[model samples]
Target: MMAGMKFLSGKRSIFKVMGLICKKCALAIMVLALIAPFIATTQIILGDSKSDLEDAKKQQEDVQSKLEETKKYIEDLQGQVSDIQSYISSLDSQMETISSSLYELDLQVQDLEATIKTTEEELAKAEEDAKVQYEQMKLRIKFMYEHNDETYLGMLLNAEDMADLLSKAEYINQLSKYDREMLEKYKATIDYIAQTKADLEADKEELVNMQTNLQDQMSALSLLQSTKMTQLTNLNNTVAAEESYYSRLEAENEALEATTRQLEARIKAEEAAKSSVTSYDGGKFKWPTTSTRITSDYGDTDGRSAPHKGIDIGAVKVGVAGDPIYAAYDGKVVISTYSASAGNYIMIYHGDGLYTRYLHCSSLLVSVGDYVTKGQKIGLMGTTGNSTGVHLHFDVRLNGSYVSPWNYLSK
Candidate 1:
């Protein structure tokens, strides 16, 4: 009975040691999974962490692009405002020139009026003199016709000498011709003065019309210039506001990065507190379940040729649909979704900005925000979103970029 008891005690001791070894092994494997993404060149397992990091990176990139585009838009708006301001300045110059021209036109009109008045006065005097001379000549010609025999003609005829008769006849003819020519000359001068007055009136009317048209054009230009100035001011204000907003966003992003670093340090300290285990030593790692070989390697070369971010582990024969999918390590469940390309997907945010992704699951066993333990069931592997058959799409992410998971796997 004592020997039997001794054998039983030995068996019990061995079992305890084996249990200890298994626990340690699992812990070490988890540690490697957490650290390998950063420290080593490794392929990633399709998991939640990888998806979270990738999504964050994509979001950051999109925001950066938007920021740049906004800057360019602001610059364009500024340029447009500048152009408007320049146009306003040009309008101001044009207005000044127009005002000056209008002033000159006013002076020209005044001078023309003065000249017209002077010309009219001179013409009126000339017309008065012509009329007086014409009346006097008519009176003289009529009187001569009525009294010619009793006047100079009669006297000249009365002279008996031949020389006197000839001189008297020539003198009468000269007087008669002088009276007729004076009447014609006075009429012609009066007609010329009337025509000059008409021309001055026409010139005054034309000058007034030209000045009115110019004033109308200047008024329109002034309105346009004022409108452009207002638009420019508004645009400048908009650009300033946008620039300030972008500045704030940049500051916020920096703060977020700092916070992320601190969290990673805390996670690292917590991980160190766990006791050491045998599984930490390099060896063939037991598959989380009896599963088929991987059908798609990490960073697969075919199709799209962009670096494959994860591996595809096929479920050939071991499990039925809706079977439990276990967590490879302890981590927080950060995201879960039925994504088009990933099917039912989950992203786990681990420490140090490391992340993992799991996809193509039939159903999720754990909700987002759940704290999972190592080997905890998180989902059921099955063909789901963007999947061809029953399999698991797994990934690893570091600082929001996809990395190889193979480097972290213990097997």
Candidate 2:
């Protein structure tokens, strides 16, 4: 309360008002006058304090608003990263297909070259045989032309008997028949070789055309692949650059809005989970992973800003990735999606407010609304999102809060 020495205008008015009352009032006035300066100072201090408090509250609100905005921005960036990765995968598939086609084309070209070599060899052999036949026919014709009528007349006059004369004439007729047959055979051979050469040239032309086509296609595919790779690289660079900024903002804003939202979502899921199942008759949950190695226990916050909500199972195998992640218990999947923090995570709702989570998965095998059995493979363990290494982060939420996996898992 603010106190003053005067009611109307001056300290005399305070004394006059008290005089009209009683001696008790006068005593009160005396006390009020003694403490008047202190009360006035206190009024100013109270006003300043209220203003300061309101200012502090406004600053807090502003900080909280900034935190939410920053979180939302980071989430958007994560989504963009996911989209770009999917595009990169698609481009990879296309490039593989192109490479396979190119490989096939290479094989065909090799076969064509082999066939052309064989054709040329066969063509050369036929031409050589035709030339030999031509030379033999020329010699025979020249010998017949030199002898001519003299040889035939000599054969007739020198004959001792009519039987010998007839035999000589028959021999001359047989020589004429041989000459005619050789000429016809040479003509046929020339025609067949000419046709074969023409066909071989056509095949060679076709092979050349095919190779030209393949080269053009390869050039186009190469250009497209180059463009796609550039896009992928740019996207990767953007993610790498923004991640640092995101971390800076995340460190400054201590609202933990993202964490709160996750908890809220789990809380909302509980109602739906309970409605779906009245109770869980299943005994102990199966181990969520093959590895029995526990890396991080629940509620442990060392090396991180926030407490760990689940158990992290390290890879105890030869490889880091592709380890099978199984369902802890039989339940219907309530949430199956990717997140900036959780990466590929799954939430399975068992009856009576019991839910399970698998985080940092390389791949998810089940979708929302799908029911899975205990020990069923749900995903492959991986180091995704905000993970440190290859591991399965298994979580159990009973009644909207994270619980210990040891309590649910069997020995």
Candidate 3:
């Protein structure tokens, strides 16, 4: 009985030890399985972090390049503003001088009117005197014709002696000479009066024409003044209230200059960043349409003489409304919209303050933030906005402002 009890106790101890060893082995296997997954996850996390760093660096470089370009644009705009201001100042000076000249012309016209009136009166008096003299001369001519033969015959028959006959002949010659002289004097007076009247009438007609011309000139001057006043008002409004337009212009210029300086500073900072990073170069650009006759050049003034900032190409050859429109440059789609004024429109950011716009599109093939390469199909053409017919309203912009699209594209 004692041997049996010892055997049973030994067997139980061995079984317990075996179970403990098996439990340890299973725990070791479980730990290894769990640790393997963690190792794989760590590797994946490291790879993702590296990729994110690379992406961030690339984005930073792009931002830097854009900042540099924006600075250059701001500088150019500031210079243009300065030049416009100088031209406007010169125009104002010219306007003042023109106003003074016009005032003097008005006084001259008034004086001419008075002279014309006096000349008219003088001409009327001269015409009446000429009529009276003409009538007196006609009566004398009739009387001489009626009595001259009778007198000559009677004088010849009544001659008593040679001396008397000679005296009568001298008297007849004197009378005839006197009549002839009087007739010539009267004709000369009438001719002089007619000439004077004709000259006065011409002078009066010229004065009337001068008055009409003066009135026309005044109307033109008034229009010019009104236009100038409107332009001045606009300039003043744009510059705000500075008491003097010149002073206001100077102040606005100063502000623009300061902004330009700040932009330059930012550009320099971006340049430094770009130097350390690999830049993501933009893709090649493609033609926006197949049609290529430019009906109007960019920045051309229309019939109203309104300045046109975009180029107008002939769209008659191209298919309307559903004609594929391609991207002109590599850019990210920034805006896609439809409005009553712009119709279906799309804006693409070509980086560095350079943007392109497609207007009057019948259809849009892109959304905002879609990165596109040059020559990629984008939209279609249609009649939209302030358009007479179906045409693509294409435009190029530098730093959020419109510029001549022709400058960037070939015919």
Q: Which stretches of candidate 3 lie over 4 Å from their true place?
A: 1-57, 149-411
Q: Sorted by lDDT, highest first, which candidate order results?
A: 2, 1, 3
Instruction: Name the lDDT of candidate 1.
Output: 0.63
lDDT per model vs. reference: 0.63, 0.66, 0.57
Measured against the true structure, the TM-scores of the candidates, in listed sequence, are 0.50, 0.41, 0.32
lDDT of 1 by residue, 222-273 (tens): 6666666666666677667667756754654554344333334323432432
Q: Pick the candidate with the highest TM-score.
A: 1
Cα distance off (Å), candidate 1, residue 388: 52
Q: lDDT by residue for model 3 over 70-180, one digit each (tens)? A: 344434434434544554454455446545665765676576567657666665665666567656767766876898778677887799988999999898788667766
Model 3: worst 10 consecutive residues (lDDT sum): 41-50
Model 1 / residue 91 / CA error / Å: 2.3
Cα lDDT for residue 66, model 1? 49
Sort order, TM-score high to low: 1, 2, 3
Off by over 4 Å in 2: 1-73, 156-174, 183-187, 190-194, 255-411
